[model samples]
Target: MEALDSPKLDEHSQALVAMNEVFQRQRKDYLANPYPDYTSRIRDLRKLAQLVQDHKDALARAISEDYGNRSVDETLFAEILPVLEGIQETIKHLRKWMRPERRRVRQLVYPLASNRLIAQPLGVVGVIVPWNFPINLAFSPLTSIFAAGNRALVKMSDRSPRLAAFLKRVVTDYFPREKLAFIDDGHQLGPEFSALPFDHLLFTGSTQTGKAVMASAATNLTPVTLELGGKSPAVVAPDFPLEVAAERILFWKLMNAGQICTNIDYLFLPESKVREFVELTQKIAHQRYPDLQAPDYTSIIDDRSYQRLWDTVADAQQKGTQVVNVFPGNEGDGALRKFPLHLLIEPNDDSLVMQREIFGPLLPIKTYRDPQEVIEYINSRERPLAFYPFTRNKSLRDLYLQRVMSGGACVNNCLLHVAQHDLPFGGVGHSGIGHYHGKEGFINFSKLRPVHYQGFIDGLKPLMPPYGEKSRKILEFMIRRARS
Candidate 1:
C-alpha cells in the first residue's frame, strides 16, 4: 500500500519540482536584469510574432485537433490573426508606454523639485490559459508582460493537450526557459500553478474556477486579473432592423460554437419582434452553417461540455421553454462531439439555461416590452462581462450605455470592442477585475513608481521644528495661499 501511494506522490512532487524550478529561474533572471531596454523588448515581441507566423498552420491544426474539429478559419480569424495584430500594435506603442511621465510639481517647490512616474516591470507573471482561444489568451497577456519587461510562466489547459504539447516543444527555440516557459496542466497542476508566488497572475476561465484561483493567489498576496465569464446579453431595440441584429448576434453566437466568454449568452428582443427575430435568426443560422458536421462548424470542447449543453436544452424544455434547433435535421455527430446551435425561447430564471453562463451554442432569449424592463432585469443580476444594445437612436444608446454597467460594451455590434487594440478590455464585479489591453495592459503588468527630486534649497526649512513668531507667520501665509 505504501509503495503504491509513493509513486502517485512522487509524480505530483515531480510536477511541483519542475514548476518551482522554472519559476525560480525566471525570478532570478528578472532580478538580475530588472529592466530590459527598448531594443531587447522589441526583439522579444518580434520573436513572439515570428514564432506564431512560422507555426500558424501547425498551431491552427493543433487547436483543431484539440477541439476534435475546430474550424481552421475560425482558429486563424479568432485566435491567430488577432494576436498577431495585437503584437504589432504593442510594438508600435511600447516606446511611448515605457517613457517616464513628468508630473507637475506643486507651486511651493515648482522651480527645482521635479516629479516623475516611471512604468517599471513587476518581476515574473503567471498566466492561466483556458482551452478556448488558447493561443490568443496566452500570447496577448504575454505581449503585455514582455512589453513591460517581465518574464512569464503560462499554464495551459488540460483540455488542450495537443496545443499545449506543441507550444511546449516550440517555445524554447524562440525564448530561453529562464525568460519564458509553458507549463502543461496534464498533471492537474492548475492549483499548484496559481499557488506559486508570482508578481501578477492573469486567468481567463469560468467564474467559479476564478474564485479558487484568486483564493490561492491571495496566500502570496499576488495581484490577479481574472477574465471570467457571465451571462452577457444583447438587446435589439425596436428601431433596429431585426434582420441585421440576427445576423450579427448569430455570427458571434455560433462562432467557435459560441464558446467565447464575451459571446451573447442571452438576448432581449422587443415583445412584438420575438417571432420575426427568431425566424430571422433561424434563417441566418441555416445559411451560415448548412452542415453541423462540416469542418466549418466547431465541435464542443469535450464530452462533459457537450453533455452539459444537451442537459441545458433538456432542462429548458422540461421547464416548458421553447427550444429551437437553429439547423434543423442536423443533430450533429455525437461521436465527434459536434453540437448544433440551440435557441431557448423564454427560458425561466430558475432553469439551468438561464441560471448559468451558457458557454456553448445555446442562446436563451427573453422578450422585453420596454427598455427599463431590459435594464432592470439585467441590473438585478451580476454585472456581465459584456452588454450589446443595438440602436441607431443616440438617446437610446446613451441611456443603455449609462444605465447598463458591464466589463465592456459594444453599441451597435458584438465582440468588436474586444478586437480594437487601443481599447482596454476587462470586467466589473462578478464578470472580472482589472483592465488589460493597450496602455492599460502595459500599466497593469508594470509598477508606476513615483520619484521626487529634491530642490537645491529646502522649502520646508522655514517651517522646521522651532515654533516662533516668524514660523507662525510663514504657516499662516502658507495656509492662506493653499486656500486661495
Candidate 2:
C-alpha cells in the first residue's frame, strides 16, 4: 500500500475537536450518574466555595491584570463576596429544593392515583461568561447548576485571558474534567462552544451577542438563559431627595467605571433639578476619585472601549449638549485608560451617547416634567434589564412599578437586587429570556419531571367500557363533578 498523510486540522477545528471530546465525556458521565444525591451536590458546592476562598487574592490579581487596572476592592466586593454569599445561600436551600413536591391528583384520577413533582438533574450545562463581573457571572450560575445535580462546562471571555487561564488551571484541582471544566477563549471558540448539545445553556453578555448565542444553541435544541444588557434607566422623582439619589446612583454608575449591565444608563431628573444634580455629581465624583490615576479608580477594559466613550462625549458636545467633566483640565491618563466621568447634561435623543448603551463612565441626563413622560419614553423602547424609580411616595412609586416592565428593579436604589441571593437574576425581552438564582436557579437548570403512581382503586375502570348508556352516564357525572 502507498503511504498516505493525514489532513492537517486548523486551530479552530482542533479546538472544536477538544471541546466535543470534553462534551462527550461529560455526557457519558451524566448517563452513568444521572442524579447526584444531596450529599454529593453539597460537596461539589463546598469545593466551589473553597476554590474561591483559597484563590481569592490570586483571582483578584489576575482580573486586575486583565483590565489595565481593575479596583481590588471592587473585585472583592462585587465579584468575590457576592459569589461566596450566593454559594452559601444555594447550600442552605439545596436540601429543600431537592425534595420532590406532592401534587394533587387530577379529579379524573380521583383516589386511584398520586402525583409528584420531582426536580431531576438536566445533565451537563454550558455557561458562557462575560468579561465584566467574570467571576460572579461564571460561578453564580455554576452554584445553581451544581445545586441542581448537574455538571458544567464554562467558557470564559477572550477579553479576560488572565482570569480565564487562572480559572482553567485551578478549577481542575477541585473537579474532574467530566464534572466541571473551564475552557479558555484562546482559539475564539465561543460560537463553537455554544453549538454543543448540552442539557441547558446560560449566556451573559450584550444583547446582540446574546441573540447569536441563542441562534447557535437552537441548532442543538438546547434551552438557554440569557442575561443580556439594555439601557436600564433611573428616574429621580420630585418627591425624592436629589443629593441622596445622586450619591447612590453615582456609586453604582462609577463602581465598574459604569461598565455594569444594570448600571443606570440614563437618568430622568426633574426639569428643575438638572443643574443641582449635575453640581452634586461633580462634587461627588471629585470627592470619590480625587486623582483618576489612583488605584481606587478602575480603567476602561481596553483601548477600543476607552476611545468609544470619548467619541460618545465628543458627539454629544458637538450636538450642543452641556458636557461637564467632573475632573476639569485633568483629562485622564490615556496610557492607563482612565477616562474621567463626563455628565452630558440633557443630551439630545439623537446623540450617540443617548442612542446606545454607554458601557463606560458617561452619564446622560434627561429632564422630565411629568412621571408620565418617563413612563411613556421608557415603554416606547425595548424593556430594560433593570428600572430604578427613586422616590419614597407610595402612590408615585406604585405608579411607576405598575406601568414599567423590566427584568428586575431596585426601588430607591440601583444594582443591589442582583446581589441578593434569594432573588432570581436574569433579563427580560431584549434584556434577556429566563432566570437563574436561588430556588429559581435550581429549577432553571433542572427538569421538573412529573411522576404518577397508580393506587389500588381504579377510577377509570367504570368509564372504560363499551359505548353504552352506563358509560355516558358516568361521563356526565364526571363532567358535573368537574363543574362542581
Candidate 3:
C-alpha cells in the first residue's frame, strides 16, 4: 500500500506557522534570560538610535515614496525625531524604572513583613503598526518593549510596503530574530499575528480594526494597548483671535495632509466668528501652501483615500453644506495624488464627513451658542482621542478642560501633546484602550509583581485557626480594640 500524504498548507497558513516558530524561539530565549540588566538595555537602545540615525534619509525617502508625495520635513519632524527622542528618554530613565518600588506593608502585617513591586519583563510583546507615521509607531513602542527587557515581534501595515521592507532589512541587520523581529508580509498574516500568545500586544490603527485585534488577542488572555482613532475636535473660544486659532488648527489639519490620528477632526466656532475664521483660514492656507503642486504639500496616501476625501466633500455639498477649497484654482498635480484642502461649513449631522473620522484634509465647522452647548455636543458622542481648546481666559480653559472628556488635551495648540515624551498617549472609549509612551509605556509592557518578604518572627502565630483558648482570647481582645 502507498503511504498516506499529509495535508498541505496554504500560503497564509505557512506564514502563520513560520511566525509561530519565531515566537516560540523568542519565548524560549526570554525564559533563558528573563531579565536584562540596565546596561544591556541601554546598549540595545543606543544601537536602535544608531540604526534610525544612520538610515534617517533612506527611511524618509521610503516613506515619501509609499505616500507618493509625503513631505520630507513632516517625516523627519513627526516620525523620526519623535522616535529618537523616545529612545533617548527610555535610556535615560530605564535604570530608575527598573528598580523595585518599595511599598508600605499593611498595619496588620507590619511587624515582620515588607512589601515591594518588582517590574519584571513580560516575555514576548507583539506590535501591530499602522500606515500613518509607520516608523514612529513601530520604533516608539519598541523602545518601551526593550526598556522593559522583553522581546518583540512587529507587524507593519500593508499600505506602507516600502517602509516596511526597509525596516525589515535594517532591523535584521541590527538585532537577532530572538531579540527583535519584523513581519512585513502586509495584512496576509495579520490575523495569525494577533492570535499568537504574546505576553502583551499593542495595536495602532482604526477603531474597527482595533476591536478585531482585541478580540483575537482575547483568546490568549493577552493584555492589549490599542491606540485607535476617532473624531477629535478643536473648540475655539469666542474671545480668542480668529487668525491665531485658524492658523494653529490649519497647521495641524495640513500636517501629513491630516493623516494623523489626533488631527483636529472638526471645529466648534462661536456663531459670530465663523465667517471671519473661514477667511483667515483661507488666507493662511494660501500663503503657507502657495502651490498645491509643491513638494511641501503632502498627497493623500492612495487612490482609495483620495477618492474618499472627494466623496466626503461631495456628500457634504449635496447635503446643503458650503464646501470651500482653500486653494481654489490649484487642484494639485493629480498624477501625484496630491489633493487640495476642503473646509466644510455646517455639514448635516448625518453626512459622511460629519459622521466619520475624516482622516484627510477635510474640516467641518460647527457653530455653538455657549460653552455649555459645546460641552454637551462633545459629550453626546463617543469620547475622542484629543480635545483642543483655544482660549486665553483661564476660567474658560479650566471649564472646558474639566467638562470635556478625552484621552489627551491641548490648551491653545494642536497635536503637540502626543509629542511630549513625558505624557502618556492613548485613547478612551471608541478612541483607544491603553497608553504607551515614556514611563507609562515602560509600565504598560511590564508586569508589576508585588512581592512580600517575611522575617523570621511570626506575629500572627498566636491568631492561628486552632480554635484554642489563647486564639479566642486574642481575637476577642483585637475585636474590642478595633471597636473602641
TM-score of each: 0.97, 0.97, 0.96
Clashing pairs in 1: none
Q: Give the per-residue lDDT of model 1 (tens digit) for 398-425.
A: 9999999999999888999999999999
Candidate 3 or 2, higher lDDT: 2
lDDT of 2 by residue, 187-291 (tens): 999998999888999999999999999999999999999999999999999989999999999999999888999999999999999989888998998899888
Q: Which residue runs of candidate 2 sit more than 4 Å off their true CA positions?
A: 1-7
Scored against the true structure, residue 363 in model 2 reaches a CA lDDT of: 89
In order, what lDDT does every prediction score? 0.92, 0.92, 0.89
Question: So what's the TM-score on candidate 1?
Answer: 0.97
Worst 10 residues of 1 by lDDT: 1-10
